[model samples]
Target: MDKIKIDIMYLFGASGHGKVIAEIAETCGIVIDGFIDCDDNKKSVLGYPVFKELPSTTESLVVAIGDNGIRKKIVDNNIDAKYPIIIHKMSTVSKRTLLGAGTVIMAGATINVDVNIGQQCIINTNASVDHDCLIEDYVHLSPNVALAGNVTIGEGTHVGIGVCIIQGIRIGKWCTIGAGAVIIRDIPDGCTVVGNPGKIIRKMND
Candidate 1:
């Protein structure tokens, strides 16, 4: 969807993450119609009404949940909803970068030239994605995470807060890089990595 055409939008998931997205939307001067959540007990969020079901409207919708798996599930189920790329006003995204639908770039994030971020991905606050980075669908780069040039993060992978990845590293799908990890080597799929050199402690399904 065209970002410029977004006048009013709705956010799915009425939680803390949703609140952050609301602030980003507001900062971008986009009017939020309301929030949609599965929780019946949630009546409102950030002064906006919350509905149990998505409203039938032409406005765009943003999946505001922070969990990669849950966000992917919601996007898959809501195939008809228009998903737009939500970039915070304070983010520094190069015009040469390509951001996929349903992706959210938080404040203070820096995405450099030729970066391609996939659908439903989260480039969290203050995260720095250097040039030529490829971030696949449903991936989350937590706050203050730093990726050097030519890094590739696979689908559904989560890089924890303050993690630093060296240049030309390829991290595989569904892997978890723990907080403060310094990745100096390639990571295989489905692994849980931690420590300074990013050792794989265990497989995700272990």
Candidate 2:
């Protein structure tokens, strides 16, 4: 059988996250060119060569790092040239879901019916976005994050890992939710929330 031509990409990190991204890419029929990382010791991961510099032949990049703050930084550094692919071969995204450009959906992520995901958003591993969820531009839903039905997440909002957002909650734009936060009520724009039941621990300082 003739091999299918696919988008060539390199994952930015070579840890567990990188392997997960590579697996997703494989499932999506994408060709992984290599893995790139600053750590020199990661010369090879899962049989793919490690690259300290960007791959000259590849056009797409996948930021496989899990940390949101660090991931943002990595994205900012790499996005100067290469286009990043938002891959989610195992994701159950509805036909009604609107996925924006430059978004990356990793494996096991579920974008339910009528979910609106904005541009440059990162829907990471095992995250579930329920029906009628509105995710604005540049939002990052970390691993294991769950949003119930009818949740509205504003632009540039970063929902931390293992967060659980209840149904019908309207999270304002640019909010930062800490890990394991359980959002039960409506949160205003620009708030930084943490802990169970999600208190406004830090207001918009900037």
Candidate 3:
């Protein structure tokens, strides 16, 4: 039988998040082909060649930008390509958990049983999602963010670094939970929340 050849995967963005994903891919024994970025001035990122555009015949790619909106835009632009779910070797993901395409679980992240993480999401370093949590598409859970059991995070939401949400709380779509914020109640859609108890500082229309 002839052996099947595997094409290398490329990481998009070529920034800090891209570098981290490169390391994680390397740890998983997956060779990174290179990086594709809009910035044409730079040559390489983390020793990998940076390309202005995705190479011809490119198939697999992962968006590694930290910003949720930028990542969403990049994924939307390249909707035809294959987006693989990359989980760091150091992270703990429950067998019952469901992770969608283009989701990256960074080092030291812990996802308990029955967690559902949506497409193009970022479970950043040292983050923890307790049992039965529902995290929607394009959500970014920053470093050290913790979510209790049965919590639901809506699509395109950005949970900031070191923030903590209480059990059974529901956070709506396109919301921004500020860093170090303590969420004690449900948050509405398209709002910017900050401080303890996670007050709504600004709405999307403002």
Clashes of each: 0, 1, 0
lDDT of 3 by residue, 152-193 (tens): 999999999999999999999999999999999999999999
Q: How do the residues 1-206 of candidate 1 rate in per-residue lDDT, one tens digit apiece?
A: 33344745789889999999999988887778999988988888889999888877746889999889989988898888789888998999999999999999999999999999999999999999999999999999999999999999999999999999999999999999999999999999999999998899998668
The digit string of per-residue lDDT tens for model 2 on 1-206 reads: 23334466678889987887777766766677899988978899989999998866766777777654566676677665455555675777788888875577877898888898876678988999999999987788999999999999997788999999999999998889999999999998889999988999877765
Off by over 4 Å in 1: 1-8
Q: Spell out the clash pairs found in candidate 1.
A: none
**lDDT, residue 180, model 2:** 99
lDDT of 1 at 187: 94
Global lDDT for candidate 3? 0.92
Return the TM-score for each candidate structure: 0.94, 0.80, 0.96
- The best candidate by TM-score is 3
- As a whole number from 0 to 100, the lDDT of residue 130 in candidate 2 is 94
Which residue ranges in model 3 land beyond 4 Å of their true spot? 1-6
